[model samples]
Target chain A: MEHSGKPNKIRLSTNPTNEALSKLKIGDIVYLDGVVYTGREGVYMRAIEDGEPIPMDLPAESAANFHCSPAAVQNEDGSFNMGAVTATASFRFSKWIGAWFKMSGAKLILGKGGMSPEDYKKHFVPNGAIYLTTVGYGTGALLGRGVKQVRALHWRKELGLAQAIWVIEVENFGPFIVESDLEGNSLFERENAKIAENLSKAYEGTRPAVLKRFGETDDRKDELI
Target chain B: MISIDLIQQTAETLMDKAAIEIPDDYLDGLKKTASQEDGDLSSFVLQAMLENYQAAKEDRRAMCGDTGCPRWYVKMGNEAQIEGGAIALEAALRRATANATNGVPLRPNRVHPLWRTDHDNNVGIGAPEIEYGFEPGGDWVDLITVHKGGLFGTDYRMLFPSDGIEGIKRFYLDCLVAFGKRGLACQPAIIGIGLGGSKDTCMVLGKRAACLRVVGDKNPDPKIAALEDEFKELGNSIGMGAMGFVGKSMVIDCNIEVGYCHTGGMQMSVHAFCLSSRRAVARVFGDGRVEYRTDPDWFTDYQRRDTVEWNIPENQTKSA
Candidate 1:
């Protein structure tokens, strides 16, 4: 178990070399090297609704064309970086799709906004998936690092930017903090618990009248003017 | 009789001039703000402000590429007469659009909602928005140019009055949680708030209000000003650590714009202009005198940070 650049001992559903992921418990820092797909709001929605297959053949430059396959992160070490393949904002999509992502063989999800605690623990962890995020709106800079690859999948023509799927090879990808793992523990859940605790304390400090004021509805038509 | 062609030509010239003409006042203001914002958030804001100046000066590019659909808000005198005022205004805008597309290479942002067709020249149905106001004794038309920067994404957070005090706190907390979760989302971004309006108007005002701030300038309304302060404090308290864990500054400025609303409920909208609230404005009078508005320190700061000498290009410095 080399500690230098390997992923901290975690379970992975898929093996680095085989299509079928094998169970591994060794505490090895696995630097991810393989084909990863990129998708965002538009891409996720279209695929879920239309049952479209992810395009794995399109070039990286045309990722924006399908809305789902435009972005990729190349590691500084010449390996497929998991920098930008995090999950799309999961809350925006239906719950059923979480399982769909697992079925699609998407080993890593990269996005800024986190997902529901239950969903990550239940769906992502058991399925051997990981989440990562990049600097938001740093797409311009991030994209600058992307090497254009051939598109592996395409879909409806009417979908334009929303229509294709691309399989990208990334390298030396990340220093991403793990929010959820195969064990089902999550950072988001911990944070939410703290928020809930704080809210409760604040509520206890407030008087009933003040709490009532919070409930008072202002229906005045003049307020808007 | 001046034909629409002349108006079109003049409008095009003004737009082109507006694109490059960096106002002395704006440059100075930017520099001042950058110098003062020694804090974690202000630094990034200052850097963003300076970057805008550099990009504009180096490439002679429009400060913000969006350069929002050309808009002309004109006040006409009651007694003023023209051969073809409306048509001239239209043609002038058309010409301006053409010039901007080629000269600035601005993004063709205009698209039909339903058809999704690109208005190749940044022109669309009733676009390059122009609004008219009439004054009884006014003698000349006064023109103002406004360019909007950035787009709406995870960088911004919108809050409503109904969101409650707890909700407000939660909103800020949520942003931090999101930032922590996603790494750094957007930094040196301008935080714009539209306090009260219809849903659509709230969003629009949020964007407009963000655009109104003069770099480091604070809001005038005491209540709203206080809210801005709270937001700033809460944002820093999270220790997102400037630029999402990096030592760079976090937010540049928080601008609040409030409007009267018919709906009893408050609708708050927020827009984040990523470290590049690249915006520029110009006022052109009928007498051919032009005044550009931007913070003056902007120029000095650019010189200081980029170590580039600040010289108002001779061609651009001349009075319009």
Candidate 2:
């Protein structure tokens, strides 16, 4: 397939600097090596919007955060079993992504479905951060395979494992799309506009048949049988 | 007679299978659609999905972290005997649900609407929700368990009797457009349309449609089946392929099930199932024997097609 460029590799032990990320373009696939905390639902909101202290030291491990709340289970002793890592919609969790970028020293946000055009323009471009989307469904194995370790540190009781912050280590974690790039491009917006035009054209072609079969009024006879 | 323990064991098996494995029809259908899709980005996405499917299978892991709340449709023979009554059967299913939560380590997805509290085990009031149907004979319970994802939920719309056939068609097309633009519901999704029933009946039909085999069958009615074909073709025209990246194969399948409606109005519902489409089937016999079913053969009188109709125009191109 047409990659924006080669699949560039970034190790999390030494996280890729903005200069390294700037060279990447929208549509580029990436593989990351490092640690990302799983805290998308509410804890992230607390850290990003409420000025609350992060459950763990994110900047020290890597500023990268995967928008995932894993499917871990508790043992009889109340400890957690290793669960699957799956990404959720980033747009829903990104109200403070700009602030997240500034405050958390974030460089990359990976999840399913990219953000709005406004979010990309306002935060991602100016901050030199990039947004990526992984496969949404049928992807727990892909996610599960990437994870090397999982340590639950916060919110197990309140949010359950699905919405808690579980610090995880990974090696070459990826198959993600550069949905929004540092170059001020939002792939999601571009594709949205394109799909809208195609749908209109398609509707134009099918209106006649639809009208003929089911229409109450046949005003568009010119396009019909 | 099927014992309560057998029923619980059967439910557990079905849930585990549905969680860890991608059904054969859906997996094959996706590969076929991916090969037909002609775009680098979209195809890449599909390939990645296939990879994940394989990984989940070989690694014995779940396809998605959202193991989803359990929903089932059970078809039993009129002569079938259960050691315990209907409540006992339901209790067994609830036990199985709890087992699946620990065994699959399924995410605690069930939350009380008012309390917003995590049920932890995923079994709650009226939970592991079961719908029942009875057949004329056979002394067995035919069951299929479906897993519903978070984004594409069960949606219903009420159309007055005056909003006739054209209106129904328009409503479906409009919904497809909205689904395409929003990307809230992932594309290359399975669309289930229920027509003419009361609100609840229409919704149940829609859910049943989503749980049916992708390439398996259509309604027995010729006129209704034709409408289904048309809907499938038109739905693909929006081109929301593989996570709304804009390609030819927007939908894997469109299932339409119709019901008799009242004189006042028609109730319509549309259910979107992502590529995961996780479901598993089983049959529990009177001898307390249980057999797991791999293919989701939900419909009996289905009219099979040669190509599962998707009309992709030749030599047409634009933005993606």
Candidate 3:
């Protein structure tokens, strides 16, 4: 749990079908050094519906658009291009965890916004899964971390950038918080419940002027009309 | 007759003046927030932001490249007459907008919804978003222009109107919680809360509030002042810390602007600007008079010292 120069590490195995879900803990820090596929909103939705392959490599023309190269790729300066691979928002793809684990062997999820099903905390803790939230609106800072390689697997080319799976090598890709752990405590759920509760209280308490002006309800009563 | 050419020229001048005037207040607020806190991370972020401001000022570059949708608030006098009226006003705005885009070298930020074409000068369908109001006594128009600087990420996406008065408190908390969850490491960021408008309009108002001067400055309404204080306290208490990781202060100032709403519905929009809340307001009179205004206390140490590279056009003279 102490901070070292290297990223926090977690070991994941995929020999058995259920191994991916069985090995995770509630609050374990994980560093996924191996290759993992990347998918965002549209790709995840399509994958869940059609079971498509995510592409792992960018075309030669597309490669030039990359902000950084893969860690294995070297520049004229002889330094590793360590790019941070961010996971897309969790809520957009929360329902596809089973499919993602089945295909990609993804051990870590990196993103900014929180996830759903407040009780997923226990699911994460016991299953060796973790959700890490990167800083919001700091894509430049995240991109500055560098890139070594871009890889994708099993996605339609027509989908263009949105469908490709990005396998990026990141250095110390953290300062992220665990929203869901193997123990099933979901930060997103906790936050939403708090929001819903506060919203309910506010709804019951205030009688804004607009409500009276609009006559309160849509129900058409003869007397009011 | 109001000339479109004249309005365009005025808009350009207003934008140029805004660019140099706004960053100082933002930088000062960031520094003040960081100094009040007791943490290494918060301090580091603040220092970095200050450096960012310095570099931007030195190069005469933008504090943050986003330089969001330029918003214009126009107040016209009932007695004031435009030769072409709204048409003249629109032409003036478009001209000023084009000038600003070229002059600032501003990023072509606007995009067409269906076509997705970049409006190279930050002008697009319903863009350089303008709001119009009329005052009874004036013979001319007064324009307040604000260009907000920040990344429009999830913060822009999370806005929802409150169902009722009770919704106001929740809306307030939602903003703070959203900031805590996703905000940067810097504290004392400007929180703009707009209550009552259509969904999009409310959000724009929230951003406009952020682009306005800090609280304890000037706002016409006392009710708004009270709400600002309440929200500020509530937001700071979230323990989101500087930059929202965990710290004593979460925001430097909270500004709330209330607008008229239709019956039975109230909307609240919240926008958070990072510690560097770059904002400038210009008051232009009917007779071609213009004055630049900033929060008096902001960047007090740096006031009256022209460290920023402000290339005011030599031909254009400042009104006395």
Candidate 4:
């Protein structure tokens, strides 16, 4: 097997400092320490849309906000069983992210597919936050191994298990790549630009469909998200 | 009669297996794809996935947090009979699905489309859909469960016969490039193409092609098989790989399933079975024998037969 050079790897605290956050670059591998929490559309709708007070301390308890719902359950005996944990697509959460950043004081956003560059430029840059995307998008077991303990779970009744807030203490909880750095640079967009140069070559012998969708782009460079 | 208890038990086991273990054929295909991958980031992603599979098996946890939508495909022999008939068999499968959702701790991915009501057990009205098929003979029942990630990497388009092969290639590329950016479709996937069926059946055939068939398996028709090979190569040549990085591992395999359609409409749908590619299968017999396997073995000659009447093969009839 051809072994390409590995990307630079670092271990950072979930509650990171300005100096610590500044050192990150796009495509660098990252492993997180300390505490992180799961929050997505459910949390967004309630905490932001419905104007519900956040149940925990902002960024103090956990600065890393993960767009995830673990394979987990709340036992009748008042305990939690969390197995594999992985991220969902972050793009869908873009609408409420700016408000989320201000309200939560979140410094790190972790998820599956990274958000658009416009999001990074607007919300992430102003808030001194960066984005780390989970590797393979299915490395749930590996990420699960990083959990030291389930600290707490919130909103079980109101939001249900999948949308409930899961506060977790983690050790080396990652295999996340730096998708966005402090300067608002996006690794995915960078890679997409490079890949676009060769797309025409790939689409060499193909022809467009007879019937077209209402709002479809023929440009290979255009991205759905 | 096939015992309902066995059906439920086997189904629960299949759900656990589908969530935790990587099927062998897919693993091998990925290993080969990994070896050939040149993009550093994409290579790392593939390697991490390989390790993740091992971690899941060793720890008995799900490979992905979004454990997809769990669904069933049950194939029975002509002589096979369930203890409480088809309805009872369906209830057992639903029970198995709910029990395993908590037991395996699978994410409750199913929900009411508008109300978004979650049962928190991966089961509700029409949830964990159970599809069926039947063979000509024997008293054995095959149970297959697939947990495929529901979002992204799938699309449908209606094309005329005049649009031809080039049109198919174009739409395929469109789905790939659109979802491929930022790794939405989760490339390095098993790409299933369904052509010629009406809209709904086109989606079904494509999904079956991707989820039911094993890696390296091809269509029985040589011409279709050839197209599968060509499409696989064509997909990998798109200058993308795992996570949409610059590489050549976008497709682990490409499978095409076709059905008769209106003479003018060449309906097409594309489905992607992601890196996790979760599926598991087992067979239960009237003799109380049970066996587990990875391949679904779904598209038999009889299943794909075009004629109205099925003539039992001479060799098989003589042996019987």
Indicate which candidate wins on DockQ: 4
* Model 4 chain A: ten consecutive residues of lowest lDDT: A1-10
The model with the greatest lDDT is: 4
lDDT of 4 by residue, B196-253 (tens): 8799999999999999999999899999999999999989988888898888888899
Model 1 alpha-carbon drift over 4 Å, by segment: A1-90, A94-96, A99-103, A147-156, A162-225, B1-189, B193-206, B219-231, B234-251, B257-278, B282-320
Off by over 4 Å in 4: A1-4
TM-score of chain B of 3: 0.74
**Chain B only: TM-score of model 4:** 0.99
**lDDT string, candidate 3, B50-115, tens digits:** 554554455554444344557677766555666577877876787687667656645445667665
lDDT of 4 by residue, A1-225 (tens): 224478889999999999999999889999999999999999999999999999999789989999998999989998888899989999999899999999999999999989989999999999999999999888999999999989999998899888999999999998999999999999898889889988999898888888887987887788884
- The candidate maximizing TM-score is 4
DockQ of each: 0.08, 0.33, 0.07, 0.68
lDDT of 3 by residue, A1-225 (tens): 112222223543212123543454322333333344445655666666776554433221121111111111223464322222223334545676556544544445555454544425533443445565433223222332323354433332333332344444434433344445555665444433433333333233433333233334322111111
Cα lDDT over the full model 2: 0.71
Which model is ahead, 3 or 4, in terms of DockQ? 4
| Greater-DockQ candidate between 2 and 3 | 2
Candidate 1, residue B139: lDDT: 36
DockQ of 3: 0.07
